[model samples]
Target: MMPGRNLRKPAPPAAPAEREVAVECALQLRRIGDKWDLRQRILNFLAKLFFPET
Candidate 1:
């Protein structure tokens, strides 16, 4: 076994409040009525989902 290696820490779990906030944000996105607002949100989401973050 390699010394002082293979000891990376696990990713921290998301907090309950963070999950709630994320849910609230998704709900808000659906509630947006303006076409431009919806389009921008979808495009941004797609970019984030498909493209590597810079």
Candidate 2:
């Protein structure tokens, strides 16, 4: 599962300004997801090393 995946789809914006806002929001969410993914992977790797049986 990816972080911020729910932000992938938002209600359609009607106005031009709304569209811009939506785009910006999506970009920011994507960046957040990238950071989360890196951290999550690191944690998972550590967990696997500490608990190999799981």
The prediction achieving the highest TM-score against the true structure is: 2
Q: Which pairs of residues collide in model 1?
A: none
Q: Once superposed on the true structure, which residue ranges of model 1 sit more than 4 Å away at CA?
A: 1-11, 33-54
C-alpha RMSD values across all candidates: 12.0, 12.2
lDDT of 2 by residue, 1-54 (tens): 788676567867589988899999999999999999999999999999999999
Error of 1 at 4 (Å): 21
**What's the true lDDT of residue 39 in model 1?**
92
The TM-scores of all predictions, comma-separated, are: 0.38, 0.59
Query: Which candidate should be chosen as best, given lDDT against the real structure?
Result: 2
